[model samples]
Target: MFLDILLYIFIGIIVLQFIYYIGIFSVFSFKKAEKKNPNHVPVSVIVCAKNEAENVTRLIPELLNQNYPDFEIILIDDASSDETLEIFEEFEKQHSKIRLVKVENNEAFWGNKKYALTLGIKTAKKPYLLFTDADCFIPSNQWIAEMTAHFTEKKTIVLGYGKYKKIKGSLLNKLIRYETLLTAIQYFSWAKKGKPYMGVGRNLAYNQSEFYKVNGFIDHMSIRSGDDDLFINQAATKNNTEICYSLESFTISEPKTTFNSWYRQKRRHVSTASHYKFFDKAQLALFYACNISFFILAIVLLVTQHQWILVTALIAFRYLFTWISVGCGAGKLHEKDVVYWYPFLEVTLIFTQFSVFIHNKFSKPVHWK
Candidate 1:
């Protein structure tokens, strides 16, 4: 009887979190672009590439051809071992707006990417700074114009979505898309409710002034891989952050092929999750705990033969709630097809969370690719 009561209480808590996510999703509408005067605000697009020779050669041309009135591309080669610098030199020959910056020696002050971004930002002559990864490709020519329009006096920080490209014969591609969609659901829903906690570094924008105001990751400098999210968490005000959902403003990146590469990348990311504020950490913990408890309780109920109908109903309710919430988010991110893969995705998420927990508990310092 005590175990049954405890299970009931856990079920109730999970239901409450389901409703909370739903309410958050329904409150703030996805951001849409509006017509505005052709104001030429000076803007700088910064991209840091380490061993991304092919991506730089291909994506730089698209960034240079943006329809924006005024902007410059600052490409930083972070001591890459590959021919990244050689490729950048070839692109710089054709485009005047494309400036190549190389970090030959680490000043021994910051992480490789952070150092590269700091160097690019220092040389930037614009008031607004946009950060994107080298592997990402912007969707449209007007992507910058559409994204920048949302940066008014009210909204200082902008978070945009990035999807993974679908590749045939690669289960890794499917998994990457599912992971991205799930992450977007949590962050986007939170952003919608003005309780923004995290933002993706791959496609994020903020003012130079805001960056300096937060001391530019001074608190988390020793820990790498959080320069984007930690900085936003420190700098963004309640009314200063906005999320962009338009297709024109979205980005797409190729997925890693091997599981080992993906595992290392995810492990690096998990280390920073603990650095979030107490309340934010509590919320995340509750969410993950519910998922784990649900799975465990279902297995116990099956073995003990305790109120099978009630247990099945609770399980169904939880599944329905997650599917709807995750489905809404997947739609907004343009991965609607992945919705059909939700059952497998949910199972995968549990294992993924367990891996993250173990990694955080036992893993050593990780290096970024």
Candidate 2:
């Protein structure tokens, strides 16, 4: 009878996961972004850099080559001790479209990227602002066009994909990308469900009005890591947000090659989740907790051989439905290779995230770099 109780719990979790898969996530898997805004509005492409000279060097030229019309590049040198400021000045000289915003290290907001970004956002000449990191590059010149196409009168926020490069023979690369794909599916799908929460800075776009309306990240300026997600979590609304997944709209960056490096990056990201709106935070926690519980209960029920056949069928059914749902999402996001490795990656990530949560309880991550 005790095993029956556990079995019921497992079934309930499966039902919850299915609700997420079918109700919230299914829209993004099959829906295509109608990137149809025909006008190429004047745009300001903003990037913040701190000791990222080499990456910024490659990025500036790639940004210079974007095919969008009537656009200018604003590169903010965030108190870099390196030659990043000099590089920005050089590009400013060579190109008339490049503008530079230099932010000195503020003792009050030391090492905070948001301080530098606020300066850059204020300096932007265009009302439409697009953001990316120093290391990111566009797959095509049509990136700005594709992203801005989603910016209609009501849709002031445009969320785009930022994918890590896939390296063969590196399991870390696959794991990082799989996680990225999974996150994208949830955020994009949630936006489709009319409860927009967050967006990646690497390919995010928004109108400057939204920034000034929210007082421009002043609310969470103390936190160095949430310039993108936190701002969207507070500013994005169902009627104001839009999703753009056109191939040209995606930004690409290199994945962290080492597990330690990736872990540190993840810690900074995870620290921001606590500040998310109540509903967003609660739903995310519920989803992750149910995922972990599903595997735990399934293993115990089967190993004990209590109603083994029923448990086996339930497990098979759950995995089959998950594969179909996630496989569709992976194909849409250009990560179909991750589909076969889904179960393994999902289990590992659940535990890895649990470790990160515990670690964050003891320590905090600082600095944008």
Candidate 3:
């Protein structure tokens, strides 16, 4: 009787997984990249740095090479202890399109990203704004063009894929890359369905007016981090949000080199999820709960030999759908290499996230930079 009950739960979880893969995730996997923007408008590209001198040095030259005709680069030095400010000043003097915004540490909002970003947004002179990290690599000059293609008069928020650099001979790199890929898949899929919730700051763009509409992150500015997602969670509606995942639009960032650093980063990111809308939290929780439980339940039933054939069938069926949906998404985002390791990487990541949730209850991440 006990084994049968377990089998039933396993079956139920597998069904939910099937629904997510077929119904929700497939929206992004089967979709095509958007066309070019004929009506490209003036844009202010914002990059905020705390102490990323070396990274920004490499980044500035690439930002200047963007093919977009009308755009300015707004480099915000958020109270850097290093030479980040000096580098920004030099770039500003060299290029006519480069601008600078220096932000000192606020006593009430110390080390807060939203505070620094708010100052940068207010300083922008353009109608449209594009944001990225100082450490990110821009491979294509058409990144601004591709990202802005979806921005019609009504569609103001544009979300793009911010991928991590692929490091060969490193399992940790594969895991991190897969996690990033999966995140893009979920957010892009949600935006495609017209229920956009959150976006990453690494490759997100929007209208400056929309920032003013939500009062520019004042609701959650007390808490550090969430300059990108929390703002989108508050500002992005079904009608105004648009998603872009073209290869040309991707901004690649270096991944955490060690497990300890990666854990801290993941914990910080997961902590922000608690502040998301109630429905967003619930649905995400459901998907992860089902995903994690599927593996656990499948293993238990197979070991106890409770309807082993039926349990095996359910596991196989769920993974088949997973491969198709996740595989297509990886392909679309040019992450086909990570798709093969999804079976292993996904199980590890889900359990790792569960561990992160348990650990975060005792300690929370307080710093954004």
Better of 1 and 3 by lDDT: 3
Best by lDDT: 2
Q: Sort all candidates by lDDT, best to worst.
A: 2, 3, 1
Better of 1 and 2 by lDDT: 2
Give TM-scores for every candidate, taking all chains together and pairing residue i with residue i.
0.93, 0.98, 0.98
Model 1, CA-based lDDT: 0.78
Predicted candidate 2 versus true structure: per-residue lDDT over 1-369, tens digit per residue: 999999999999999999888777899987754647556999999999998889998998888899887999999999999999998899999999999999997899888899899899989999999999998877698888988988888999999999999999888888999999999999999999999999999999999999999998999988888999999999999999999887788999999999999998999999999999999999999999999999999989989998999999998888888888888989888899988888899998899999999999999976486
TM-score pick, better of 1 and 2 = 2
Residue 77 lDDT in candidate 2: 95
Which tens-of-lDDT digit does each residue in 301-363 have in candidate 3? 988888888888888888888999999999998999998898999989998999999999999
Per-structure clash totals for the candidates = 0, 0, 0
